[model samples]
Target: MGGLATAMLGCPGMPELPEVETIRRSLLSRLEGRRLVAVAASGSPLRQPIQEAAWQACVGARLEDLTRRGKYLIGHLGRHAAVFHLGMSGRLLVQPASSPAPAHTHLTLGFSDGLELRLVDPRRFGVAVVMPAEEVSLYPPLARLGVDPLEGDVEAALASLAGTRAPIRNALLDQSVVAGLGNIYANEALARAGIRPTTPAGRLSPARRARLARATRDTLADALAAGGTTLADGGFVDGDGNGGYFAVALRVYGREGQPCQECGAAIRRAVMAGRSAFYCPRCQR
Candidate 1:
């Protein structure tokens, strides 16, 4: 593999918390208070099949709010809400109704306005479901999710993994330990905290754990501000279908063999659980 390709070896294709949150914020203005005038499904199956009856219930309902739980987007509509998870390579796009529907458009929701919200996923791993708004927290995916690293006490959340022998990078990827974290940011956060990705979660000292937690939040905040990372292959976009630019700010996630900004040593990459973990050899210990 070439330099950049080799460096991006194990970065996940799935959208993480920052990407999802960006989508939520972008869609909120366009979708909130707008009545759903039409709804359609292509009968294609995703991670789970698109529930037609569930979506049909959303017709004529007004979107009151849009929120994020982990990597999922929940749009509140009166008594019901639509929940969406952009599994690998899925995108929720907002475009003028006059525009031709993009290929692989599995679901289309037309609002009272002239715009349409479409779910396009060529890989068919995304999810779209609707249920009572009051029961959203009880939904299986949201119910099982751990604390939001940005919203909750991430240090406490990391405390739960203190007993696990797995590498700290692997532990961060656990949705039950810190919801919304993906492989890329996990590695970047470790790099920021000056810790090796392969360090055992259980072996981290209390001070190190606190530092990791802070670094994780800071990494996410920076990514969120940059509109999230869009890699060459992943093609992540916001609600308006604009791409993310955080890739330029990445420190070590995909810069294998590049000089560490901190210490002038070449960055390194290691394969862990089928994913690549990038770090600065001289700076991280």
Candidate 2:
């Protein structure tokens, strides 16, 4: 693979905490208090099918709340709910009413203010499900997600990590184990903690694990602060329509073939559990 392709492949595709957090913040800014005049869905076969009549029945509602549960974005439109999962390449775009809908735009919500919200998913892995707002928790996808990494107890994250014999990187990617982490942040967090990616989750000393936990939280917070990373594919954006932090402050994620900023060691790349992990062997472990 070429340099850029290799770098891009190392990260996970889904919306991590930072990306989802940015989306939540953006929706809060642009979508809150907006009346949903209409709702529509396209793309021949959705990853999760939405029945047409059932979808329309939920339209014409007002947005009551916007929330992030793990990697999912839930929009509460009074009496009904609009749930979105930015699986891999899905983008929630806000556009002026006169603009032509983008090619991959699968869903659109026309607002009363002459603006439109579009859900564009080139890969079609993302899904949109509409249901009664009061019972959104009963939906299978939202129900299956674990605790939000940013909001959940730190001790709980440590306890969960302690139970897994899998490598710490894999443990973080498992949604049932800890929600909202993808490969990019996992590598960044491990690098920040100076922990080897292959280290067993259960084998770390309490102090080291604590450092890892803190690094995880801090890395995510920083990413959110800078907005989510923006790739060449135009996947993520911040609240004010800017590039993500990953592109700005990434240390080890896409820096392979370059010297480690901290210890001058060459950044190494390896596949673990079918995902590429970038780390500095000399600096880590």
Candidate 3:
């Protein structure tokens, strides 16, 4: 079982972009074309202040599109939309109108088809609020974020990569350097790039930087293609309540002490910026 490179990572907490994007794709079917019959804000406010009245703005509007930026979900209605950040432990599940709402459910969006979408987060880090559709672009968090990593400016990312002395893994995790990456993905991408997780970002050769950029895209694409990774404790899942299977395809994330896929060297583990980093010491750097 430990011989594989893509073993499931045991760390579970805040989800990265791939997980959030998977939700957006799955939710599009359940949300688009469905009119919001009602919106009820229950329980405490999530990460962002949950405006009970602002949610009312979505009532009667049709959920036309579901888009994702980094780790945020944008539910579009023609003139307005709702912004959702799943923070840690946030589960946006679709259930029948007759289905009992789960505990910690803070926001509920009832649709015209007798279905309901609920935002349930035990840690209460998720956010859901309806606002002017165009307002998503002006929102501070989304606006201030860096490159999209998947389809964003590559030259800009390379420039940032060339300018930072921070640990390569840490720099990748910076939303301001490259958006949508978390600790686990950072380690995965670095492993894919064949760059040591602790290598200084600015010290990478031109070839290494290029590989890092391509590795980031390729690794993320691989994860998305497989539906995203779901770790232990199940912090991430598709909108339909199913966990992603990408975790088993991981290259080096959370494989400490296991044999490397490219080399027989045992995978090493380290703590960077208080987050776990897994890499094949012989394969990387």
All candidates' TM-scores? 0.95, 0.91, 0.93
Better of 2 and 3 by lDDT: 3
Query: Which pairs of residues clash in candidate 1, taking residues 3 or more apart in a chain or in different chains?
Result: none
Candidate 2 residue pairs in clash (backbone atoms < 3 Å): 13-88, 228-244
Ten consecutive residues with minimal summed lDDT in candidate 1? Answer: 1-10
Tens-place lDDT digits, model 1, residues 1-285: 233453345635568888999898998878788999888899989888888888887888888999888888888888997899998779999898999999999999999878899999987878899988888889988999998988999888877776789999999988988899988899899999999999999888889989999999999999999999998776689999887888888899878899999898999989888778899988899
Give the candidate number with the greatest lDDT.
1
Instruction: Give each prediction's root-mean-square deviation over alpha carbons.
Output: 3.1, 3.0, 4.7
In TM-score terms, candidate 3 sits at 0.93
Candidate 3 segments exceeding 4 Å error:
1-11
TM-score, cand. 2 vs. native: 0.91
lDDT by candidate, in order shown: 0.87, 0.79, 0.82
In angstroms, how far off is 251's CA in candidate 1?
Answer: 1.0
lDDT of 3: 0.82
TM-score head-to-head 1 vs 3, winner: 1
Residues 56-105, candidate 2: write the lDDT tens digits.
77667877788988888888887888788887677888888798988888
Q: Write the per-residue lDDT of candidate 3 for residues 106-211, one digit (tens) a residue.
A: 9988999899998888877677877787787998888888888888964457666665788988888788778899877888888888889899888888878888
What's the residue-level lDDT of 158 in candidate 1?
Answer: 76
